[model samples]
Target chain A: MTERTATIASRVGLHARPAAIFAEAAADLPVEVTIARLGEPAEDALDAASILALMGLGAAQGDVVVLRAEGDGADAALESLVRILETDHDA
Target chain B: MHTYSGVGVTPGRVVGPVRVMPPAIAAPPAGEQREGTTTAEAAAGNLRSAAAVVKEELRGRAAKATGDGKAVLEATALMAADPMLLKSAVKLIDAGASAQRAIWEAGDGVAAMLLDLGGYMAERSHDVLDVRARIVAQLRGVPAPGIPDADAPFILVADDLAPADTATLDPAKVLALVTAGGGPQSHTAIIARNLGLPAVVAAAGVGELADGDEIFVDGGRGVVTTDPGDAEREAASRWAEQVSRLAGFDGVGRLADGHRIPLLANVGGAKDAVAAAAANAEGVGLLRTEFCFLGHDTEPGHDEQVAAYKGVFDAFPGKKVVVRTLDAGADKPLPFLTDATEPNPALGVRGFRTDGTSPGVLARQLAAIADAAGQSRADVWVMAPMIATADEAASFAALCTAAGLQTPGVMVEVPSAALTARHILDHAEFASLGTNDLTQYTMAADRQLGPLAALNDPWQPGVLALVQATVEGSRAQARHTGGPGRAPKPVGVCGESAADPALAVVLAGLGVTTLSMSARAIPAVSAVLRSVTAETAGSLARLAVSAPSAAEARSRVRARLPVLDELGL
Candidate 1:
């Protein structure tokens, strides 16, 4: 299992176009990834690939979230997701 | 014949059969039962296939759309095919929930979650609800939510139209619009005016007009009548014909003595530029930049802003396009830029005032405008709204010049701005009076308040006095700025006031160099301008400002321009 924490860079947070972009990136990964608020329990996490769930996380701009991936290339997937999360889609 | 009265937001008349839009879909009962194994499997199979079908339909529509419309349709398609939603529905179906009810409940759950998130997320509630209704309608074998298709031209009667529904309306098929609800500022009225469709909004019991029932809608009089007399029918047709003629007029707006008053359109986005061009507007007088900012989680980047700006500027090559910078605050509180709540948002930070708290936003927008201006053929002019002092105008003008925008101006919406227009225009190049806000601010009446709508009238002598002051001040500033052989600094009227043909003449008489309104209003205003000389307009302006009240002022002007009654002004 590999996990990484990143702050939401999108001015509007992890929602709308930003959430869609992040979800699309997660969906393209070979490993199944889950995301949750940084301090929340893993059970509260949502499938990173699901746009609605990702949006329902209510992660606003500047919020910190943790992403965990477990599978082949899990480390690479976590790295890629972290990079996408840090990028401001609104900008 | 029964008749109902409301406010006429859009002008003209039409007689046609009524077509009332169906009400929204109701949520399915939660206690629905699915049959045993085989039946449950069949229902699940149906739900799966129906999702795919709706997704495909959305894809087809998405392909046909452009810009933001294309993005929205594509996103809606994604929501329809969401794997998470499918799995949830299947589980509910296995738990004795019918397939239709399961889909409705699952979709509604997600929509509720989004709505709970609020702000931008809550705005998506409508889209989610729309997709849910579509899938449920498919499973139940019923019509989808929204306007129904008609075989012929008819009057569209609805409780009120959502922005999405109004976007898809076909003016050729919908001869008129009568709504049981919606104030003058509602989306329905705005769309009706933009489309040049005759509309009577807030008409009580408009929904009672049965489908295929012949009705006559007098948009100017705000009356919907059934069984009109011969004279009324003839007059309605004549009025329609006159409006068409006015709409078809391709000439530049001018007075009887050939004093040119460049009639322009006030557009919210690039899509409206096409309509303004079709209406033969000399140019865009007020291009609102809020469309680029609205619904976004954050401020749009330079590239996106430039693309949006260039779209409108390119549409009117060699024509003037006056763009107002992002005027967000108060009524349009941007979460990222303003406080969540204010005791008096109307009097609080708004318009150009956002510069204090959100510095880079305005600068980025100005930079984008400058970049877009470099790429387009249109003459782009930028302005700041709600500027009250010459110092602010000077600073704004300085920043605009530094950013390579030479023609910077300020909106005379604030009473102080109007009172000191001479000094403000000395720093800025021109002034455009936004009478809606000016009247609202002058009369201390909230524009959104229906009960005070009468008090918000632009024809109020107090508002007219402010307008006259701005125009005279602008003329003085223009002379001071020009050493010799230079035209005076142009002061224009770009508000609902400009849409009133009688007031357009009065505005011109007050030395307003231009008139900008909805594209549909251009023709009647142009026709009125042709009948009145600049000198006559000046006298009317005098009579209007001297009156004690808005009603008295309106009547005084009307008494002088008897031709207005003939033109259905």
Candidate 2:
């Protein structure tokens, strides 16, 4: 498994437009990815491709979250997802 | 014909077939076993297909939409196909739940989770429910719950509209809006106003209206007549003709004799100023400065304030722009300026009174206004709100002069200010009547309460009397200082009353020098003002002020002004 942590940068956090964008990106990747707030139990992780799950995570602006990916191109998927989380879509 | 009454938020008339928005989809019966499908796997497969169908339909709509609408639809589409949602539904199906019940309960669980997260996340729960409804409707072989599709123009009737429902509304096909629920400030009324669709809200029993039922909607009077006869149809046609004439207003306010009365707009920020300019407002009458102060925990710096003010000032080059100082407190309390624990905020320290608690804030604002004015060619006039005494006006004017700005004014919102306008004008250069506040203060009624709407009306005889007093005091001041031929200080009205065509005429007749209102109201006001002479307005004003009540005042003045009926006002 490839794992990464990134802080939410969108002013409104991982909801609405930013969540939709990240979910679309995650769904397009070859590797399956799951996300959970940092310090949350591993079992609490949710499918990163689901906008509903991302919104349900309640990740606000400046919150750090952990992303884990598996299978082919896992590392590349984690890197791209981390970049999306760090970028301020609002700006 | 059965007639339903509601509060009218906009003015116009129309008759068309009704298009009732479909009610929300009912939740599926709980604990029902899977039908037709032989196994749990078959039930789960059915759920997946239903979700896919909903996702595809949403994706189709998202492809055609743009901007925020497109973003919302795309997000909803993603929710429809969310794997986690399907997994939960499938889990339920394995536990002996039917496909319909499984998906419904699964959707609720997700929505409840989002709701538990609270704040912005809680708002998204509604979107989940909306998507769930669509999927459920698809599975049930029923029409989706939302705005119904129609081929031609129709009057839309709904219990109330959700913000998402209004997003897909095609304004061209909506002739008018009538809702059984919601008030004048509801989402439906506001959107109706923006789309220029006549709307009546809080109309009881309007939900009973059926599809394709002919209805006559008189938004000006907040009346909905069912199965209207030829007379109502003729009136609707006449109103349509009058509305087209109103569109031709040349952006100038004048009387029949060509006496000019400048029509200005009340704007909140630079964006509103741009729209006001596009609407050809002679200038801004009330540029509310609270936008800079409302959201900040600490006061905005001098440069930030200057930049914000300059944006508005730049929009009306070489034209008058009257800016009201930060009127914080009472209903618009600011943490940095007001004591939230005050027993009576309305009667407590507010508006100009806030300066006493937070010194230098008003001074800094004045300096910023002067700085912005120096950079722009706009004729900037500064004013303070909630001034109850001549001394407050003098002190406020002194601050303006100290900041190197001229043309300091005071808003005549308090009864005392109107009573002592002659003295207040002794120090202030101009006085603008805020009729909404003046009426509230005069009648001792809370303006925000719906029940007090009658007493809070600007047409109340007591309120009109105070307006006359302020105008008379201004004239008296002019005579005292510059003799009989001198003009009174330029007193304008920047209030909701100024937007009413009939009331605008009465205000002009009462010696008000200018009328300022929302940008959308300028055309109708300008058109109506051009239909009456100064002499006629004076008589109408007299009739209004001498009337016993607000209703009587309105009827008396409206009866004398034949142009109102001619224009379907």
Candidate 3:
């Protein structure tokens, strides 16, 4: 398994709509994302993109985040996430 | 002029000039530049210097204002410190726009940026946002909606209060606080009630209130109009006087025939307990211990719980305190109890039976209550909820006895508990009727379920039958234990039910030795009890229990009583 780093780019960052979009993207996939706060350890509680749970991570700008993908379309899954975060869907 | 209604937030009547906050003024346009200034940089410098002056003025005022006005300064100070706004302002200044334009544009940019960064309040507090909006308006020389004090007494009206802005207002000077917007949880509302300032928000056309106009504000009815006629003024004055009388009341529960029923305060935390104790309340009726254990990684240690209990107990030297052990795991959630699934949190495994399963949690909690009680002269009573069978009640009694706790009691909350109060009391020293939960369970309706809330009325015959049955069971137990005060010691009502003034009289009249409720509602309840004699109260309680409908129950009580002179009812 390889881990990649990405920033949240969609305008409605990791809240109600973003949580749904990100959950749908990860459903049934052999991948996991841990939303970490500016200075916190990643934990299993971040298994789902719950708006409140994600907020616990406290991710903000100029911050580093880790995404891990395993099995077959790992590359494709990681690439899709990068694009999702890079574009401001909230705009 | 438009007139909207809201809860009256502040009290009093004043007639004076209205001082609307000054509007933010914009600088000269680029096309109309001064003869000497050919470049946009010159215009930018002029605008920048002017903004500096306004910002400084804002800073100076925030430091000086009192009450809600002082809160505004605190919030304004924070808005003035926002990194995003400050950064944008710098950028606009670099781009050569006028000072006012730069400030306004910077604010707009920051709002747009944060709205895009959504999460669960990840953008920060609404109060912080309000501060930015007001500052920007001031920067542009636009009419800021801030209410002002014009030396003389006058009605103060506005759209809404920023927490900081509403904090500095003088309750006495303020004729009334009439605003266009707010909710039950709004800061203005909380502060108004906390400070005993009668105010009304959600009033329409409050801004249209011209200067030097005569207006009478009814805080209780949430009304503010231009000079109320004589009748209305008399009525409002009577109500105000009544409220003042009730607020000053400090009497204990007494029967017209001279019987005594202890009136106690229901406190949520040690701070509340201290405040109540200072008010000369008989003792704490319900000390919600959840405040000590909530938001923690593990269950609090015996020492920690004991410390908390001791603080509340120490506040009142000789007053009795009833400590209700852990009412959490339902309606209330503990940080570590996350995975405990609940289809409906309110009606589910809460009160006591649910938490009792963990002996370690129970034992430590029991020991803590016992220890706190030992330190004070006041007798500390230990109690639990949701105990239906004799076995459950006995187990709690055994635990409390084992831990040296006095008078381990059972709360008659569920229908099962009320139906078998005799059996439950066999193992306990006392019983307190929690009618709110009993009514919910008896009616088979979720009390918190808004759509079906009507079914949970305490006056419903089914609910009344359950309460009457519980009282009957208590009486039966008294007969078995050698009669009168010798039975299980004491019977009381300690819940939201205990807060109702009319209901307090009824409960005391029904032989309940004590009635406990929020400290704020205690004075009013005491006044109601004092007004009626014990003989009248007993019969009234019977009438209430016999009523078929909630409205009928209330009406019957009111028809028989003269009036609520002190409470202004």
Would you estimate the TM-scores of all the predictions? 0.77, 0.75, 0.59
Candidate 3: tens digits of C-alpha lDDT, residues B1-569:
22346544333332233444333234334423123443556545554444445446566776777543454354344344443455465566666554445556665555554435432232333333454555555545565445564566555665556544544566666655666555322455545544555567656556666566556666644667665567656766676566666774464667666778788887767888888876678888777788787544358778888889988888777777888888766545553432245676665666665554444677778988888788777678888877778898988899999999868988888888878888888888888877767776677665444334346555565666676677778788878877666544477787666665666776766668888876766776777777788888888888887887765886687667665533444
Query: Residue-wise lDDT of candidate 1 within B432-460, one digit each (tens)?
Result: 99987898899898766544646767888
Candidates ranked by TM-score, best first? 1, 2, 3
Q: Docking quality tier of candidate 2?
A: medium
True contacts kept of each: 0.33, 0.97, 0.00
**Least accurate 10 contiguous residues by lDDT in model 2 chain B:** B447-456
Q: What TM-score does candidate 2 reach?
A: 0.75
lDDT (tens digit, per residue) of candidate 2 on B1-569: 99999767678999999999888898888787776545998888878999999999999889978876898799999999899999999998898888888889989999999868754565567788888998889888888888877889999998877656677889988999998876554467547765668888778889899999999999877899999999999999899888778774466889999999999998889999998898889999999999888645468899999999999999999999999999988767676788766898989889999889889999999999999999999999999999999999999999999999999999999999999999999999999999877887899987655445456678899999989999999999999999989989988899778878889999999999999887887888888888899999999999999999988998898888787777776
Residue ranges of candidate 2 with Cα displaced over 4 Å? A7-13, A37-41, A52-64, B5-9, B23-65, B76-149, B160-169, B181-190, B201-203, B257-259, B266-279, B286-315, B323-374, B381-491
lDDT of 1 by residue, A1-91 (tens): 7889999998768877777777778878998999999899998888888777876888887899999988789999999989988999766
Query: What is the lDDT for B423 in model 2?
Result: 96
lDDT over C-alpha atoms for residue B42 of model 2: 85
In model 3, which runs have C-alpha deviations exceeding 4 angstroms?
Answer: A1-91, B1-229, B249-251, B338-341, B354-359, B443-462, B483-488, B565-567
- The residue ranges of model 1 lying beyond 4 angstroms of the native Cα positions read A1-42, A45-50, A57-91, B22-66, B77-122, B129-146, B205-207, B269-271, B274-280, B314-319, B330-348, B374-379, B443-452, B475-488, B546-552, B565-569
List TM-score (chain A only) for every prediction: 0.96, 0.96, 0.65
Better of 1 and 3 by lDDT: 1
